[model samples]
Target: MKNKLEIKIILSLCFVTIITAVTAVPLQSAHAFSWPCIDRSDGKAPIAVSDDNVYVAWWGNTTGNYEVMFKASNDGGKTFGDKISLSNSTNGTSVEADVAAFGNNVYITYADNKTGDADAYIRTSNDNGKTFGPEFKLTNNSDSSLTSSSLPQGMKSYDNVKTSPYELKVAAEGDNVYVIATGGDKNDTTYQPDVFIRVSNDSGKTFGKDINLSESKGIVSERTEIGVLGDKVFVTWWDKGSDGTDTPLLRISDDRGQTFGDIIDLSANATDSNTTNTTSS
Candidate 1:
């Protein structure tokens, strides 16, 4: 009778345990949201969102050298994959990096001092962010002559130096990719930084002519950000006028950046005030 009673007790315990487990299991909550899966000890820039996922890239100083890092969240920022370092160089900083995703591919652009003058570089990953192609310097500043020390401070640096301080913006539509950057040749002292756009139809294999965006003479335009919706390409920047005042500006292009409409003043109230601005379409 004792043995029989022991067997009954064991069965009861097992049944209770199973019932508790079934009741304790947590269900997916509607409040659940995506979180960072990677360590963001370094500063992170604005992230780009596509249909499938979101991409975020950042720069950090590691062991006295600057490195570019990337992370992607598949479930709307709920979880991210392992972080990856894109740049192989050890000295230059990766400051203004931007990411864009289309279909299963992700494209990144940033300013790197690996070449010493803060030139622009690009990398693309086909199978999500699993792998990236070889790093390509978008601006050919490899020639040694383009340096402030080599030429007069006021001289143009197109042949000698390439100073592209702003982040490179990229948008992919259909099979073509469009990139925009702001830079100036060293010699045009009167020429503030100008926005330039390039297009690649062959899956980033080659790029086309550079198109200038800004026409304001002697006004310093910098920190450009770009976005695309359908055929419209919009760019926003902080422009420092000759009057020593800063303004937030936006320019839209309906013809794939071939031509731009009038500059829209986003901060009309704060015309001469220093205000940070951002826009998305």
Candidate 2:
């Protein structure tokens, strides 16, 4: 009986060893477990998919400074390639990156503070995010030079609340790219930080003049999103009404952002509950 018990114990020990070996084998990482950034990071994490390809962009501190970084996956986001820095220059930090792709073209826009001002900048990748072209400054104006855009005056409220920060969001279709953002000082209620837009016809290689789309007096306006579908480009954002009441607004461009009409009010009863449109086609 003692010999039989020893044999049973040895068999149990062997079974335990076999289970441990099987479980300890390093398996392949999951699809979402990819794209490792080295430093402190901020990820709006705008991603675009083109059938089998996936492109992602963000602002990360991989090299001790915040720069716009991109990663691409050819196999449906199963695995990603190495990081591609898209700031176009290593001189200053960049943040608030927004990326969009159409066909083989990828466009990235961000607020670059390399010169102590957050100017809207853009870069293009003609090869599905593998490489980027030159940088184009959309707003061209310094932070202080930007004026607070107004909203339509009416039975509005003013809460004396501040405006939002300067951040860039962009969208693209074919060779056309549109960018929207806010800029300048927030403390000054007069000339409050305003929302602005810039359009590109040649795939973000060049941009048109910056247009202020707000219309309210003594109001602060900021935070914007741009979208393009067919020939129409749509923009939306929140604004502090003439009296600090919050208002949600929308506008559409029919001729590929050549001109915008109909600043539609999405919110009927306005308050401080800010609403923002943060995407585009």
Tens-digit per-residue lDDT, 1-281, candidate 1? 21232332221111100000011222110000011112223346657676768788877777576577899877788889998998766755565567777877788876666654445677888876778998866664332323454455654543322333354677876556677766553333453565556666555666655555554556666567777776777878877887888877787878655557767778776555432232211
Q: Candidate 2: list runs displaced more than 4 Å.
A: 1-42, 88-91, 142-165, 184-189, 269-281
Off by over 4 Å in 1: 1-42, 142-164, 185-187, 262-281
lDDT tens per residue, model 2, 87-165: 8446666666788888888877766646533345667778877778777655322222112243124312221111112
Q: Tell me the TM-score of each prediction against the true structure.
A: 0.68, 0.68
Error of 2 at 215 (Å): 3.0
lDDT of each: 0.57, 0.56
Count of clashing residue pairs in every prediction: 14, 12
